[model samples]
Target: MTPPLAVDIDGTLTDSNRALDPRVLDPIREWPEPVVVATGKALPYPVGLCEFLGIPVRVIAENGGAVYLADDDELEFHGDREAAQRVVEEYRELGHEVGYGKVDFTNRWRETELAVNLDQPLEPLKELAAAHGMHVFDTGYAYHVTSPGVDKGEGLRAVCDRLGVGIEEFAVVGDSENDAAAFELAGTAVAVANADETAKAAADHVTEGSYGDGFLEALDSLRDA
Candidate 1:
């Protein structure tokens, strides 16, 4: 039997322009096993994606700050939101723009962490998060400030427990550092051709294709396995 799939959204399922590639929809919807949409994006994005894709609403959002399973209608939050918010506030006080400007929706719906635009200086942000006992993850698209124990691996473990599946019974795919934890827990970890170095290093296999094509390639490999 093919292992269940846990896949990232941005660099993994999107095109170079960061738009969702329609190509991945049918295959994911048709997959026999459960498919989890794991991403550094906010909870609503992945949840809505699952609804639109006609798949189970299983997701690890905010880089693992949040986990939701539709089967049981469960939603769990793991990160320290207050601490993350404080870091962002301090960053703003330092005269550094969060990058998303005022009235930023990128963080409006975020409940457990802060997602800052990539244009901001990473080092200072990292330092601030660290000072608050939080961690900053660069997902290649944004800088995510989350609690130390909150990560995709732990989120996946939570989902697995609810589903009665082992942590090693999933095949995970991603293209950034935020996905590394899930890679470590997966039985097979796949990275796209455009994957960041950190992601490639953790992956068991690197696809020759990029973006959604790479995701399709990974799915094919799983089917063949």
Candidate 2:
């Protein structure tokens, strides 16, 4: 049996603008290689894709900071809650503005992390963080403020640790900066053809197509391997 292959849903699997090829998901469900959708998108995106693809189960949401097993309706969240709360409280203490969504949905510490929704741009956020002795991390959508160091890379590492799978056994696929870590973690890092240049550069290989077709490309790569 093949180890789990962690895949990204949005640009790597299906283009929200276009429908996914149901044929692709068939291999994932029937083949020995089990697939896990690792996406930076929120719960809704992964859930919808899973439903549309008839994948009833699969997906690591919020860039692997949270994992949801649709088949079991169970969630395993990552992140240090106490640490995140301390950071949030610190932000409050410092009077820095912050914005977040889906926070109260789960009280678990490991599932939630400190995310700074940027009202402006990263340069300003970096300047502010540097002035405050805080670290600013990039995640494509936001300039994340963290205690010292934390991001999707660490989150992907955690998932691999829990699953007891090594990089040699799995393929990590994604289409954004957050996906960078998983790219390094898994043996083969697959980036969608539509992925930004930065992402493509970091990837071990670029998919032949976009979204749905890109997934097929990665699947082909898997078969070739």
Candidate 3:
């Protein structure tokens, strides 16, 4: 049986500019594991990447805030609708320029969460977040904003609740301040060497190396553990 696998995208799966490393992809292609790509990128992005990897049907996108389960052999949506709306409402009230995510008929989640793209500057974004009593930080090419207390950790916990699994039953890998909280709860938390200092500090362990090279190394550790 495939041991359950939960991997992160962005800096974890790809390099700094959203580039995929064939070296890492090779191992994952043959990995005897249930791989899930968790990231802040909503449908079409990670979804398409997972498909290219020939592993579709399941993905935890938009950070841990959304989950996609293939419908009729094709993915359409993530988890609860009500919860997503509630969270979006809270985020908007916090003054973020939030927008609902509805890719190919999936609305289980309804917010962009953050704008981490090559089209914007970070300073103004930080000032805006500061003025609104929120926080904005970068994760490679994306920016994250949430009321003083919400993020991937909260979403990961929701995943645990939905799955009826304990924190110790899973492993998580990522590379940013956003990834810190969830790392605390995982059975094994790994940060790639190229990760920001904050992520490395919070990590239960650091990946043996950088990005793609390091991810493959970390997976071996999880399989061994």
Candidate with the greatest lDDT versus the true structure = 1
Q: Count of backbone clashes for each model? A: 0, 5, 6
lDDT of 2 by residue, 31-125 (tens): 56556767655556666676766665566765556676644566776545455455555565555645554563322233445456656445655
**Model 1 agreement with the true structure over 1-225: per-residue lDDT tens digits:** 798999999999999999999999999999999999999889999999999998889999998888999889989999889999999999989999888877888999999999889898999999999899999998889999999988999999999999999989999999998888899988999999999999999999999999999999999999999
Instruction: Candidate 3: give the clashing pairs.
Output: 39-63, 67-78, 100-110, 116-141, 116-142, 116-143
Candidate 1 accuracy as lDDT:
0.92
Tell me how far the alpha carbon of residue 220 in candidate 1 is from the true structure, in angstroms, after superposition. 0.8
For TM-score, candidate 1 versus 2, the one ahead is 1
**How does each model score on TM-score?**
0.98, 0.67, 0.72
RMSD of 2: 5.0
lDDT of each: 0.92, 0.63, 0.64
lDDT of 3 by residue, 1-225 (tens): 224556777788877566887778767777675556667666566678778888754566655545664532433333333443444355455565333334423233335344433344556566656666655646665565545545566666655555556766768888877787778877778999988888899898897688887898888887777
Colliding pairs, model 1: none
Misplaced by over 4 Å in model 2 are 1-3, 16-24, 43-48, 51-58, 68-75, 80-119, 129-149
Instruction: Report the CA-based lDDT of candidate 3 relative to the real structure.
Output: 0.64
Among the numbered candidates, top TM-score falls to: 1
